[model samples]
Target: MKKRLAIALMIGAGLLIKAQVGINMSAPQAILHVDGQKNTAPAVPASYYDDVVVTSLGNMGVGTKSPKTRLDMRSDDRQNAIGIGGTAQTASAAKAGALRYNSGTQDLSYSNGTVWTALAHKAPNDFVDAENPSKQSFTSGTQTIVTNWTKKTDVNGSFNAATGIFVASKTGVYIVSFTFSLASGTIANDSRYETLIQTNSASSATNKVFKCVGSYPGTNGLSNRVAGNCSGIFNLTQGDNITVNLNQALGTSKTLDADATLTSLSIFGL
Candidate 1:
């Protein structure tokens, strides 16, 4: 009785294998729907399945052709297995592992889920100014013109090897003073004379402001030609010019050369 039951089970298995569904490789359908719903169209949910193991029978792969087939199965379907016989691939799956745009003209691109672009451009600024001169000059006259003072000097009214004058240019008040010296070219302790002078544009007294004479009249009623010095400050203007000249005003036989010079000159603006 057991042998008879086993033979009947074998027959039932053979019938099940014979009646199972399969692909007819000789003829292919462009669109295949098992129950009234198409299977090849990508599902709205982005993923779905159909009832039986369905596949492409021609050169087009599954999902490549219109209404292509899909198999809905909880487990692997080995009974009615369809061969992946076509070389055609779907558009979505074709570009899945490939780059979209890879041109040099494209500034932006994607890499490893990140978006990137090229860098920016920039530059700096420039400027320049005028250079200053190294020296200035003043004449040997009674006019006390202010020097173009690029710098200050320790030697006031003293002969400058570069400019020959104590120069000034900045407009302000100053204590204008000077010292004079007499040389003994004629006699021993013959005479000595000193004078202080300050002048500006407002002073019309022969281009002279304040003049002070310090000397002793000799036996001949004239200044002695020996050694002398003098300095003083006067109420001055911004561009005031001042000067001093030596004279034998108190003695006779008096010979005075360019031995007299301004020892110190300054202006203190108010």
Candidate 2:
């Protein structure tokens, strides 16, 4: 009796191996089809129904029947995350088109055959600002105008307008420009109308400065108005501060105009 039962079980296993297999399905659509919810009436299972299939081409599909690629996944949850969790990978440990999570850096990254790189990316700093909404004032001497800029396009938060300081977030060659405008005030022609771009803190021993002086040789004053424009290219290191200065040798004080066209500051990495 035991031998007869063994022969019957062998026949059943042989039938299952040769024919298309279906679990909770009347008709199979692939080599192996499993319908956890037993959804058979609909040609395609709804998102609520959990289904899996191994196509004739040996392609696997989850929550779908007609898979377009080797492994197709679809669901209402909207998350088709696939993780390759394991040990940290060496630079060339994996072949091209491989992905892994770097346990050392805790980063999800991919390999380009040569090295593993983090998938997350960030762009360098590039900023433009204009208009001193709060009109400012300055006396006759070099003054920091980088502060108090009202409309700042500080996407990367690389500058602080309140403190009039710009700290570089990356080491690169940057082009910094600024324009200082006077509110129709008296600027006597004393060859002192200048704009300066300074790098590093004032107390730093290795301070760098770029200065531009406007040449107003006429005896008459500049319609009692003066404008200073200057730009400089500097190799800046991270944590370095940038200061835009305006020097005017005037007896009386002058208030800054809230004009964007007349005054502005712009900086970007090269």
Q: Which candidate has the top score in TM-score? A: 2
What digit string (tens of lDDT, one per residue) describes model 1 on residues 168-222? 2323344544443333333323334435454545335345445555544344322
lDDT of 2 at 136: 68
Superposed by TM-score, candidate 1 places the C-alpha of residue 44 at a distance from the truth, in angstroms, of: 58
Q: Pick the candidate with the highest lDDT.
A: 2
What is the per-residue lDDT of model 2 for residues 1-270, given as tens digits with 9 covering 90 to 100? 999999999999998777888898878777888887786555444642367888878888877776778898874444566667854557577777777765333456777889877888445465756556555677776565556775558756877777667877666688998877778865555546668898994235478999998765657564567777899999877667887877666656677776756778887766
TM-score of each: 0.29, 0.54
Q: How accurate is candidate 2 locally (lDDT)?
A: 0.72
